[model samples]
Each structure stands twice: as C-alpha cells, then as structure tokens.
Target: MTYFPKLLTICILACILGATTFFYVKKSVYIFDTNYFKINSVSRAALKETGSKQCKNCSEGVPNLIIQYGVGRTATTLQFQILCLMMAFLHEDEINDVGCYYNRRNLVKKYNVIKCHDISWYLTVKWSKWVFMTSNHALLSRRLNYMRGKIKDKNTTIPFIADIDLVSRRGHYIVHEYQRFFGISDEKMQHIVEYLRYWDVLRVCCGMQMSADWRNHLAPKAKYKQHHSYHSPTYPACEMYNISQVEHLLVNTYVFKKLSHIGSLRDVIGKTSTVDGILNGSYCERCNTNISKMHLKFNQNCA
Candidate 1:
C-alpha cells in the first residue's frame, strides 16, 4: 500500500476535469467503484456570498484552515504542486506571478501566465510563508539567505525543510539538487529538514478535496494529464474490478471529516482504493463503518 496509486487516482480525476478546460489532452479518467460510497446527500456546491468575487487579500479574512498549512513536502510533490497552486488560486492567493518551483522555479508557462509580471511577491511574509508552508524550493533558495536573517532578527517563523533521507530519495532528488544549487549551508539545510511537522500528501489530498467543495476555481487553458507507474496497485485493482462510472466525485460529509484526521493514503497501495484514496482505519466510528462498507463494496466489485 503505497501512496503512488492514490495520487494516480487524483491525476485521473484532474484529467477528467481538465478535459473541460482550454488546454485539453487525450486521457482517460478512471472512475473507480463507488458502491462503498453510499452517500445519500448529493454533493452540491458549498460556496459563500463573501464580498467581491475575488479574494482581495487572500490571507486577510480567511477563516482558519481555509488554506492548509502544509509542511515537509519534497520534489516528489510536483503534481501536488499543481493542485496546491490551483487550490491557492481558488482561495485567492496572489500566485499568478509567483513562479512555481516545479522541478524549476518560474519554469511552467501556465504559472508564468499567472504571474503579476513586473511585480514581485519576494518582500511579503505571505509569499515567504507559502514558500515555507508548501516548501517551494525556488523562492526559498533565492530568499534563504534573507529568510535566515529574518529568523535571526525575529522577523518571521522558521519554515519547514526536508532532511537527508526525504530529500535524497528517488522521487525526491530535486530537494538536494536545489539545495546544492542554492549553496545553502549544511547547518541551515539540516535544520529545515529536521523540523517537526509532517503534512503527508495523502492527507493533503483529502484536505484539497475538502477545499474542492468551496474552492472550485481552475485554469481554463492548462493542459492536464494522469500518470501511473507499473508498481501502482490501483491500476491492477482497477483492471480487476473495472468500475466504468463514478456516481459522485465528491466524498460525503462523514467521510470528509473522517479523512481529515486518520488518512494514510500515502501508505496505501492503489488497488481497490477509496474515493479519496483514504486508508481504512482500524477503529470503526460511524464514518469508518461506512469505510468498512466501502471496502466490502470494493471487494465485491472485484469478486
């Protein structure tokens, strides 16, 4: 049970939604079996009549948890970066001009079009905060020397960074490369990686899903695609069970709440995955009872 397939599921869903966007690509959105998701209340748009249609100052009046305070993500977070930035835009974070550190900063054209050209977010604490929160390496590298100075002067809190293992791992090579390329000191880099806080991608995915309920904004012209590896359990599971259509793309309130606390999608293999790719918990609350039912349904689908 690895996090690989769960991410694939998300990628698939993103491609499904991408089909409607301006940048379209040929792809299949594998709609998994949802006999387990016996959600009676149909998922509906849960938007608020908050003032201007735009988020003038994203951080200004956002209720707690409006934008997730993620921590300790690595280079393996490429796809999640797209989703995170997209989520941030929905929340009205001024990121159009903020070059995304996807493999390289300010590299992606879509995000480039999103920038506030000529304007720089480099001076703001929000920009620094987001870089640290989401572990945006590009901006962090450019600002690291200044950021360390800020911490010394008590100007800002320390941002999370990756450690030796997490950064150097196979899908995480970029962390090291970026750090070396930026000439970050061993001591500072070590501290960034060792700091406490583990915002798992699986958990982030679920959080993003919650954001999806209200923060449904998206790019109309960005091309989207799904990627899955040979080791992805979800691929095999899909092949075996073969769910043709997904009734509701949304996870209900109960499952949503349940996923918030105890999801281990990062650890779960892909086959017979949950809608949110949430891992089934050992303890069964009413919500988890539904998860149990979901597992049963998935097994039944395969049977």
Candidate 2:
C-alpha cells in the first residue's frame, strides 16, 4: 500500500510536468507563428509592389520630396517624439515639417492631425552633436562644408547654403565657423545665411516657428487632407513632382544609392507574403509577381 501511494505520486508529478512543458512549448510556438505570418504578408506585398512596376514613377525614378527639419524652443523631447510618430504613421514621401511641435488647435485646424512617435535618432545624435559641441566647432564647420560641396557637385542648380542662427552665441559661432571653412564671402549669400540663422534661432528660442508655421510656409491649406487608407506615398508623389520628372531625376541622380541598405516597407511586405503562402498554400497575386521572372530581373539590375 505504501509503494502504491509512492507510484501514484510519481505518476501524478510526471503528468503535471508533462502538461506544463506542453503548454509552454505550445504558447511559444503560437507566438512565433503569429509573428512569422505577419512578416510574411508584409514581405509578399512589398515584392509584388516592386514587381508590378505599379507606381513606376515613384519607384524607379524620383527625387525624394523636400524634407524640412524644424527645431522647437520648448518641449524638445515631445517634439522629437511627435516627429517620429508622424514618420511611422505618414508616408515617407509626404513632405511636412518634422522635429518640432505644433499647437494642438493648429494641428487639428491646419494640418492632418495624425498621431506620430519619436523616430529621430539621426537628429538626436548627428545634428545635435554638431550643434552642441563647443570645442569641435571647426570640425563641424568642415563637415558641413564637405556636405555642401558634395551637394553642389550633385546639383548645381540648387543653391547650397548653410543656415545657422545669429541670435544665440553658439549659433553665431557655428555660422562663422561654417563661413570660414567654406570660403563663402558673397554679401547676398551671407545675408541669406543670416536670415536662415535668424529663423532657426527664433524657432528654438522664441517658439514662434512651430510645425504649423512650417506647414503654412510650405504647403497649401487645402492640400492638407487626412488619408484613411493604408497606402504609403512614394518619394516622387510625396514631393509633388510630376511622375515623369521624378523618374528622370532618379535615373540621373546617384545620391539615393544608399536606400538599398535600409530595409523599407517592401521588406515587410515580402515577409508577410512568404508566411501567408506557407500557411495557406495559396499564392497571393502580389506575392506571385514579386517572385516572378520580371521581378528577379529588376532586382538583379536595380542600379
């Protein structure tokens, strides 16, 4: 009777352990499968989009829309957070002022009031370092000059000007250093630079130049409509350039060669498509095109 009890206890303990292990493993597998499936759907969509040559004007050739960076006076963190959130919600091609905060009323009234998160590590690290480094002003100036020089080489029609604030002592130093490094001595150019500097300082110190201000400056009030659909705009369309013009620019300009490094929405689509295919055994039309012969050809010769 004692041995019987012991055996019963052992059997019960084994059953419990086995049940626990099975449940744990099952949950983990389910989670993994869910994520895998989502990724596959996104991937397939991207591949299909790439293959279909749909939105060809935006895809194959187009200049990135003009991106305006806004610097606010107060609520720096909030502004950064909002900008990142907007990036997440909005299409990459949509040209709007980022890196600044807007009045809640103004956001609702004047622009599309979409919720965005902070996604500006580039500004936080790269731009902020150049702005804040007191001792490395000269180095910063040299770097800005080099960047401008490269821009000049790429597009002679576009005027290359480094805008810095004149009101703040730090801003003045940055402008002086930049001018010295770049050998920019033209009186008109200097004045324009000074004006840009004034605007930036006013933006940061006075809180006058917020996102709303930028919206008024760049886009028409009527054009600021909220989009309910999930379509993300491409660079050319977002920039408001004619599709043909964007295509020509993309063909001529070699600047965006680095886009291949950063994984885009296409990657997401591809993953989603693959997962869906595996699970359903049904080929999605979009996913099919992505893996099609024509798509393979484009992928090989995307350059």
Query: Per-residue lDDT of 112-187 in model 1, one digit per residue for the tens?
Result: 2111111123323232222232334443445434444544353333223332233334332233333321234455
lDDT string for model 2 (179-290, tens) is 3222334563344343333223222211112233222223335555542222532111222323233333322322122111223211111111111221111222222233
Which model scores highest in lDDT? 2
Give me the candidate number with maximum TM-score: 1
Report lDDT per candidate: 0.28, 0.29
Clashes of each: 14, 27
Compute the lDDT for candidate 2.
0.29
lDDT of 1 at 204: 24
Clashes of 2: 27
**Model 1: lDDT to the true structure:** 0.28
Please give the lDDT score at residue 162 for candidate 2.
Answer: 23
How close is each model in CA RMSD to the real structure?
A: 25.2, 25.2
